[model samples]
Structure formats: C-alpha cells, structure tokens
Target: MSEEPPYVVSPTADSSSTARPATFIFLHGYGDDAEGLPLGLAQQFQFNNKMQYLKWVLPNAPHNHEAMARAWYVPKALPNAVKPRVPGHEGEEDAPDDEVGIMQSVDMLDQLVEQEIKNGTPSERIVVGGFSQGCAVSLVWGLTGRLKHQVAGVLCLSGYMPLQTRIQQLRNERGIKDDDKDPKRWFYVHGTMDMLVPTRLFVQGKDELAKWVDKENIEEHLYQGMGHSTNSAELRDMLAFFEKVIPE
Candidate 1:
C-alpha cells in the first residue's frame, strides 16, 4: 500500500468571503490525480466575478503500478466475462469487478466528508463527485444510507455504478424499500458512445439509484457520440446543477 495522495486547492477560492464557502470535492479518474481536475476547472471558470465563494478539493489516488499510474482499486475479471478495459487504454477487454477496492475508497471519502462537517461546513453545502472510477466510488457513497445525509449532492461524469448487489442488500438490511422516494440530488451524465463502462451500465445505475431517490430529483444527461470522457456542454450543465443544489 502507498501513502495518502496529495490534494489540490483551487486559486479561485475566495479567502475574503466571511460566509462559510460551499465545498466541492472531486475524485479523479483512474491513472490521474488531484491537480488535473481543479486545474482544468480553473482554466474554464477562472473564478468569475458572478460566482459565489467556493472551495474545491481534489484528491489523488495512491500510486499503483511501476509506471506510476494510480487506480482506485484493482479490477478483477469475472468468470467467463470479457476483461474490463484498462485505464488510459482503449480497445481492451473488460476489467474485473472489485468491491473491496470501491469500499476502501468509500471509507477514505467518509473521513474526508466528515472532516468537512466538523470544520463548520453544513452537510447540505457539500457536493461529492468523480469521473469514471471516481464516479463509481461516489455512487457507492450516495447509496450508503449512513452517508446519505453527509452530502448535498453527487456528480457523476462519464462513470458507472459498481457493487449493485451489495447496495441492494444493504438497503434491504436497513429496511429501505424500493419505492421510498428520497431526495434525488444526484446528477449523473454519461456519453452514449462510452464502450468502457457502457451506456447500459449507466442506465442500470440510474435505475438502481431511482429506487432510493425520487426520479424527479435526479438529473440525467447524455452526450451523443461522446466517448468515455466529459465535454464542455456537460461541464456547463454541471455548473448549473451545482448553483441550484448548493446555491450561493
């Protein structure tokens, strides 16, 4: 195991604002780390004058292989199933399922969110999000009833839900029936052309999430001809979603 990954803070942060700033925590995609997402966002938004005070947190995944690529968890191949595609590589076989890894990331995230709550940020003012593998972990965090109130919103970009069976099992254990319509502050966006975590999985993720959250509360978007990545249009909508969910 490696040491904890470093985090990146956005320069757009308003230090002069007296009010407790709304916090957005982003988990990086596989093989990537903390600085990239915030840097990218900074490039676009540039902390525009109209935007409210905000704090962005981007955490890097621990280094994995010798090549220095970081993975949230090691993908495991299922019996007779095609190998899952490797990160940063296209046209690869299906990768294996790794619930253990997903949960481990969840545990780490739980601490991160809890720390924010302890540091004077309200649960409703915090938004958690990720891309690809990061997205999978964020979904797990949302599905967990214990952590449901810990965040105001979840942003999933070019990602899919993992450990579906375990989520249902836990829900059952908690006596949360399928029809319970809770707050659907989750915003999930995917590309229709995504072959890695196919569009089918994205749909399945939405359906499973619907069991807990009211359909009307959840926001879904699809990018036509887009691959396993995000686009400018999606980012714009995500900003809008945040403004509504977190507010100024």
Candidate 2:
C-alpha cells in the first residue's frame, strides 16, 4: 500500500453541504487494489442517483506482493483434500491472519464512520460492503462487532460464509444478544460458478450459520453463469439493495 494511498470519497450531497444521511464503505478483494470496483460502483451510484443522500468511501487494502502483483493477503495453498481442481494464483508473503487483520480494518472503518458522524452523518446510516475476500471480512465484522453503532446495511459479493466455529467465538466475545435472530441487515451474494470459493461452500456455510441464527435474517442472491467477478446484473441488484436499505 502506498504510504498515503488515496481513500476516495464521492459524496452525493450538494456542493456546499458536508452532511449525508448514509455512507457506503467499500472493500476490494484479494489481488485487487482498492480503486477499481469500489470507484466504479460509486460512479454508478452517483449517476443513477441511488441513495442520493449517501456518500461512498473506497478504502485501499494494505498491499502485499503475491503472484508478482499486489494482494490483500498472502495466498494459502489449499491442502490436497480441500484444494480446488484448478488452483488459484499464489502471491508473496505469508498467509494472512484474516481474523486479526479484518478486525483491524473494521476498526479503521469505524473510525472513518465516526469522523462522518462528527461531520453530521448518523451512525445508523452507515453501510459496509466488499468484494470476494473483502465481502467475507465485512460479513464477519457486521455480525460480530459492537452494535451500539448500528449500521444501516451490509453487502457481501461473491463471498462465502466464514467457518462456523469462528463465528461462534465472535458472537460470544462480542456479547451480541439475540444470537438466534438472523441478521436482517445483511445482503449475501455469490457467483454460481465461482471457482475461487465454490458456491457449494456457501450452501454448506449457510447451513452452519443457521445453527447460530435464524435463517430468515440473511438474504441471498446466487447469480448464475457468473464466475469470480461481479457482472452488470449483480451491480444493478447491489444498487437496488443499497437503495432499499438506505433511504434517500
């Protein structure tokens, strides 16, 4: 990551106004820097006037050298029994301590949201989302983090649910009440043909997640014929989801 890599914000409020009703914090996936998808989505949201009262924040992930390129975390080569038929590309650096790194990132995002609130945005109007690995991290944070600062919504794109045992620990550690209540604010999405994290894993993970919370709380959208990346339809659906969750 650049010492001062850009943290882009495209606000929808009038030029002279500093306050917005909502904020969307976007996280990018592995091997991808922060600029592309988040910026694109922000542009789309701006043009379509989706959630016109919301502002978009695209935060760059801490960089690591892997696959001769930058990556969010060091790629872990899967064990033979669990490896994908076609292995994904590997990058430099040791495997990430995902739980710790993600929590740290969440802390950073929380600070950003707090700053916005200081500038007049409400805590309830803040949303967090991400692509692929970014999606996984956001989901984990939303379900486990302190809810005194309740977020408006969360978007998980092309990602799988984290391991069940970890979620159990997170719930316990956070003292999150209503563990049985599903996370109604969550929007889960996955690509049917995602080779990186197979859709089957999501199905299995959902089943496990139900052991901890009501299945009704989480909404899922499985996009057919899509691989590891987001498509136009998914983008439209994401915009609609955000619009519905965060009022203009």
Candidate 3:
C-alpha cells in the first residue's frame, strides 16, 4: 500500500519565505481527510507577523471498515443492542487495546516528528495534537514517550486515552509519581456533553495523568454544550495555549 501523504498549512504568503522555527501537527478524526482542518485551523489561529514562524501538518488516517473512510486503529466490534444515551458517544467504553494498529500509527507519527526535526524544527519546539482517535494516539505518544522525543506540548480535544490499564501498570512498576509539578504543559479541551468519549474519561485522565505529570502542568477546559466536535471558543483557547506553550 502507498503511504498516505499529509496536508500542510502554512502562514500567509506575505508573511515570510523563511523556514518555520516550530511545527504543530494535528491528526484528523476517523473518517476525515487532512485538507480541510489544517487550513481551517490555520485561518482561525491567531495570525500575526510572529505567527508566521508556525507550521501546521495534518495527516490522513488509513482506510478502515467504513465506506471510503479512514481510521487510525481498527476498533473492536460493539454489539448493536447497546446504544449511547446521547448521540456520537458510542465506543467510549472499549479498552484501548488495538496494539497493532495503534503501534503502526505511532511509528508513522514518530517518523514524521523525526522528519520535522531533521528539516529544521527541534524536538522541543514541536507539538503533537489530535481529535478523537487522533487524540488517543497523540496521548500515547506524549505519555508513553513512544516518539522518543520530548515534545513541547500535547493538545488533546474531545478524546480519551487508550491503554489505560497498561499505563497504570507501568506507573506502578516504575514508581512514577503523578503530581502537580511537571514542567511540560499539556492542554486538554473537551465538551461536557460529548457522548463519544464521555466526560468521565477527561476527569479520570486528568487525575491519572497528574500522577505522572505535574498537576499544574495539565490544563483542561470543559465546554458546556459542545459535542464530538470543535468550536470557535476552543479555537480561541487553543491559540492562547499555543502562544503560551510554543516558543517564538
């Protein structure tokens, strides 16, 4: 199979012809392509002369069971008899155990990160983020150190962390402490009404992550009525998060 190509979103033409010093990579949700979002997000981003140094990369997911759709991992089948009380909240209860597919996606992302570093950006200046399934993989990369690089930050939107039990096991085995003193900043934005991943995941995630990272380093926001999608408020907050976390 041919490797999937990623979409790139750059600063305005008048901004600069110079190379960017930092890179932001956002993975698309399942069933979506890479084109629309990167550009949309770029447009919504705080655009300024200083922002010209930022570059956005969005990669497409691999083809999955859905007709003409792409997914990062092969989701386990869920019985149709069970339904979520709210729409779009299905599959929130499954274990994060798609090791084969998840590992493959992680490898691909790691290569992308390495390429970005080789191209000019340093590991510390690169941020990896995603929505939903993308968020899951990004979470793995950020928390598990699977990227083999310490990223500047991780942005997780309306998503849940997979392999929860494994993570807990590792923490127990390694004596890793979860505290409010982690130096790296991680931004998590979720909707309270999100049925897809559920709000409990975010709450549980924050608490569990705090055990490994500094409690202060973790920043989370819950939108009141939002669903399994992004909104203007989140974009505005994201821009601010970028400004605070991404170096000039």
> Each model's C-alpha lDDT?
0.72, 0.65, 0.70
Error of 1 at 37 (Å): 3.3
Clashes (backbone N, CA, C under 3 Å), per candidate, total 8, 3, 11
So what's the TM-score on candidate 2?
A: 0.79
Candidate 1 local lDDT, 209-234, one digit each (tens): 87767787799999998887777788
| Model 3 misplacement above 4 A | 13-20, 46-50, 65-68, 76-96, 168-183
RMSD (CA, Å), candidate 3 to true, equals 4.7
Model 1 bad stretches (over 4 Å): 10-20, 47-52, 65-68, 76-96, 172-184
lDDT per residue for candidate 2 within 101-124, as digits (tens), equals 566665666666667678676777
Error of 1 at 109 (Å): 1.0
Candidate 3 lDDT, 1-248, residue by residue in tens:
11667777764535455544788888877666676555566666635444666888888887865324577875543333223232343454453467667767877888888888898888888889888778888777666544533678898888777776677554454454444133457888899777667787777777766666666778899998998888878977887887787745
Candidate 1 versus the native: TM-score? 0.82
Ordering by lDDT = 1, 3, 2
TM-score for every candidate vs. truth?
A: 0.82, 0.79, 0.80
lDDT of 3 at 174: 41
Residue 106's C-alpha lDDT in candidate 2? 59
Using TM-score as the yardstick, the better of models 2 and 3 is 3
